[model samples]
Target: MRPDLELVANLIQTDARVLDLGCGDGELLHNLQQHKSVIGYGLDKDAENIGLCLAKGVNVIEQDLDEGLGNFQDDSFDMVIMTETIQSVHNPLLLLQEMLRVGRECVVTFPNFGHWRCRLHLAASGKMPVSAHLPHRWYDTPNIHLCTFNDFEALCAHLNMLILQRRVVNRHHNERSLINLAPNLFGSYGFYHLGRTT
Candidate 1:
């Protein structure tokens, strides 16, 4: 499992209902089910991923995230999760609202665009940076609204979302002591557990 997913799995309650958005091949969901005893459902637009989910005996639905999530009723799940896919969304804030609407809490992880490496690369080269975490050319990348850790926190505040927990780690997914001091600059990825403010 990816280090971020490992941390996410630890956040889930045993026997909780989980809805995973852009759930790739259901790897995280599968892990959650087996270890945490959670009931998991996955949503992915890719047909190949949907097939993989089925083969793994995981329940999955085919849906485009950009089209919105009207099918799920409010507070239908204990937790919703979206990992490594937020930057690709057309309207991340709207999607986050929907996630909180349908689930009591949500876990989201994304690459931190404000990391020193990315900033230095752009400053020195006058072009977008492509690193191990963000391994894509600017034109062909799926990421549309890349953001920093600060940017995401501000958005959550603006949306009245309460961050329950946060973790910042390097590209290897290891937490460094220094990340606590300057997360936006040193953290390569950010994982957040958030809920709607009461």
Candidate 2:
């Protein structure tokens, strides 16, 4: 399992209802079901991922995230999850709102564009950074709305979303002391657990 997914799995309670958005291959969902006894569903647009999910005997749905989550009832799930997919979405704020509407809480992860490497790359080369976490060329990148940790926090505040937990880690998905002091500069990626404010 990816380190971020492993962390997310730890956050979920046993027997909780989970809906994973952009759930590639349903790996996290499968692990949750096997270990935590959670009721999980995955939504992915990729045909290959759908086949893999079925092979694993995981409940999966074929759907595009850009279309919105109108199918699920409000507060039907204990949690919703979208990993590294926020930047690729067209309207991230709206998507977050939808996630909160359908589930009590949501877990999100994304590459932090404000890290020192990206900033230094821009300063030195005058171009977008191509680091281990963000390996794509600017033209071919799926990250259309790349943002920093601060930016995402601001967005959450704008929506009045309560941040339950936030973790910033390096490219290896390991936490470091420096990252704790200045996450915007040292953190390579960020994982957030959020819920709508009551």
Model 2 CA lDDT for position 173: 96
Q: List the residue pairs that clash in candidate 1.
A: none
lDDT of 2: 0.95
1-198, model 1: which lDDT tens digit per residue? 977888988888999999999999999998888888898889999999999999988889998999888999999999999999899999998999999999999999999999999999999999999998899999999999899999999999999999999999998898998998999999999999999899
**In candidate 2, what are the lDDT values of residues 100-174, reduced to their tens digit?**
999999999999999999999999999889998899999999889999999999999999999999999999999
Q: Best lDDT goes to which candidate?
A: 2
TM-score for each of the candidates: 0.97, 0.98
Residue pairs in candidate 2 whose N, alpha carbon or C atoms collide under 3 angstroms: none
- What TM-score number comes out for model 2? 0.98
